[model samples]
Target: MTRIQSHPVLGNTSERLRVPFYFDENLYEGYESETIAAALLANGVRMLRVHEESGTPRGLYCNIGHCMECRVTVNGESSVRACLTTIENNMKIYSGQQLPNPVKRMVEQE
Candidate 1:
């Protein structure tokens, strides 16, 4: 993965903190100031998740959070937008088919 040390418009990103995160059990380094998608892309991880229905491979699309193509399970939470979620230290990210009702549960009645 290559990082732009200097840019004409954005300038240098060297000042950003290099935080360690995990993607499917593998360790990788990324800047804490950027989103999870950006960090994954920087690490050459393009395949975020597969299509839940057809089982086709998918990656980042319409990176402004308008598309759900970049959904990834972040730290036990499924169907999280990689483009919208920021990279946190030691984050456990997973890429696979989206699980149904991952955050929902039936309440027990008294």
Candidate 2:
């Protein structure tokens, strides 16, 4: 069920070469070099992480990397933004963690 069997606009999907990776603790298959967000979306992943204040669900808003909405931790580091980061074999991604209080304060100051 990891494949988008059907898409409204993309239509009856073709098989994507499976690349192994883990998100949280679940194993997912995606194609190499594809954006992590795109691969996740194709597999019907609607929530990448939750907002800190409201704990509301959020996912890719702008497929492009400009918006931090699709941000997720990769390989123990939060530096790699998912929308811009390409999926690689054996990569680990984490989601739904709050920003550090200091970072949150900095954002509020801006």
Candidate 3:
């Protein structure tokens, strides 16, 4: 794992509850205190989602929940920010995909 072993403020990753979560149907381990983006990045898994319009790859950006770049689906909940959500045992996380353009579709139908 590429996690920070020690930090000036957070200190070290003291013993925390190890939780298992599924991402894109693959199993991965994380800590309960970590957000989805942090856990996935620590596990060496980036590219959280693809651009809905262009299908370009996207990852954690402005992790404070403003840019919406780290969006993911959790336990069937859509558009959940990975940077703000805490990990949970047995949680099902699915990467966001390029969704159809609703506005474009409406114009096409007309």
Candidate models: Cα lDDT each: 0.85, 0.78, 0.91
Per-residue C-alpha lDDT of model 2 across residues 1-110, encoded as one tens digit per residue: 46556668755545456688888888887776678887777677879998866678888788777878887889988756788998989899988665557767889999
**For residues 3-108, could you state the per-residue lDDT of candidate 1 as single tens digits?**
7777788567786678999999999898867789988998999899988766788999899999799988899998899999999999999997744543343433
TM-score (C-alpha, index-matched) for candidate 2: 0.72
Count steric clashes of candidate 2: 0
Assess the local accuracy of residue 33 in candidate 3 as a C-alpha lDDT between 0 and 100: 82
Residue pair clashes in candidate 2? none
Judged by whole-model lDDT over C-alpha atoms, candidate 1 comes out at 0.85
Report backbone clashes per prediction.
0, 0, 0
Ranking by TM-score: 3, 1, 2
| Model 1 clashing-pair count | 0
How many Å off is the CA of 109 in candidate 3? 8.7
Scanning candidate 1 in windows of ten residues, the lowest lDDT window is 101-110
Candidate 1 residue pairs that clash: none
For 1-110, candidate 3 gives per-residue lDDT tens digits of 78887788755776567899999999998876899999999999889999989899999989999999999999999999999999999999999999899999999999
CA lDDT, candidate 1, residue 99: 42
Q: Top lDDT: which candidate number?
A: 3
TM-scores, each model vs. reference: 0.82, 0.72, 0.86
